[model samples]
Target: MEAAPAVLTFSPSSSSPAGPRPCRVLAGPAPRRARALAAPHPPRAVASSRAPLVVSSPPPPPAASGTPATTPAHAKVDRSGRFCSPRAARELALMISYAACLEGADVVRLFDRRISARREPGYVFDKACLLSYNHMSFGGGPLEVGTEEEAEKLTSQNEMDSANEAEVLSAPPKLVYNSFVLRLTRELLVAVASGWNKHVDILDKIIPQTWKDEPVARILELCILHIAMAEMTSKGTPHKVVINEAVDLAKRFCDGGAPRVINGCLRTFVKDHVDNTGTSQAAESKA
Candidate 1:
């Protein structure tokens, strides 16, 4: 067969083929090993598993008509773009008091400028009462709860001090306009500062962990509740209304869960201080 097939020989130094030209060897152990090594390793399979369970808060209450409430025309917008609802005279009062405490501005001057210009400003008598409360508790000066008649005395005394010469007191407190609301707010401020320890005691008993763990975070909530509980002590408004207003305020200024915490604290306060006899147990004790 065309001169017997040449037997193939292998040598490292040889460069040419030694077998017949037409014959070829394609399946060899060395080539198989090379192909196996060159091939990519397949990806390993991971076991399937379910995601971890998570506890979530309940959904928020539904809106009345799925529309956001509009701000009242009387609401005052401060330099910082903070709007206080016209009905939020109490909030405005506290804001001024806090400003007085932190900014070192005279309480009288701040009230004259900020609260005086409101659409339905609180009674000057109530303002004087607030000034007296601020002085005694924060200012550490004196406490003098003024009567309705003292409204005139307060006006005449501050007449020369104010630019609005027509009105004896620049911001004369309203007589019938939200009187209960103003009284509630003023009393709250007074009770909070004057009875600071008592409120703290109530908070300590109700939510001790909050006071101990996150005192700073809960400061606003505590202040709101302090005022709410103070308002409750007067017996002029129902407990539910006080709690609702406190929760609403917390929702506005505080982070999530604040409203719930406030509600809890206020409910506890009501349980302890309010009686079915339609009287404030706390007030009766004071009397």
Candidate 2:
């Protein structure tokens, strides 16, 4: 993965609001923060792919009525490569602690060995996770969930390609890049340094920082913000979403609470903010 350019330093234009804010560019795996808060505005020129915030969010969920998330027994395996009864509990106990740094080299070896080891019940899932981390060595960000949405898009896209094959394929070169989103991704990695045991590695250098930059400190802030967002969300998706679905998700995940809070908050953000996210190819050709 190419290194993102150093953050552009500038005093806010008079039009911009004033306050403390996390780096708007961080966009890697969602960091777990000690708390969460509204971040200051992003640079309107950055063209971030995250849709601009629009609507007001719904009220956050009330305190829970004391229920626990249950993990199944088969999910846990001992270091000896043997399964234990009461699996869920044991797995939680043995699992890597929060922010545990299972290094890049060690991660590669562990995955290679685990994949070749055997076919356990959840072995495939475990293998996928390890392979994913390896890819992070090259590219680390949210792994897209290949759901029905993607499948339908893929099929339609494929059909269009087949029909258009007759057209001349040659075209002038154009850089396919989103500087903002890429920057967001790198900043997130720095904001949450999970590749080692609280140690900075090659990733830090790739993402250049200003003269006054602290790796561990920034990561902590990112983690706090994300965690607080989840908690305030009643453990639902914190991202802004379409209206009805946002409400429904909150209700389902928040143990049957009012759904409007999530919806309102998301709607307000999208409505109020301006954005410069990259357009899909469809939009570009039309332009």
Highest TM-score, which number?
Answer: 1
Lowest-lDDT window of 10 residues in candidate 2? 168-177
TM-score of 2: 0.19
**CA-lDDT, candidates in order:** 0.42, 0.25
Number of the top lDDT candidate: 1
Model 1 is weakest, by summed lDDT over 10 consecutive residues, at: 132-141
Error of model 1, residue 261, in angstroms? 0.9
TM-score of 1: 0.43
lDDT of 1 by residue, 161-182 (tens): 2222122122333422244445
Error of 1 at 285 (Å): 4.4
For every candidate in turn, the CA RMSD to the true structure comes to: 36.2, 23.7
lDDT of 1: 0.42
TM-score of each: 0.43, 0.19
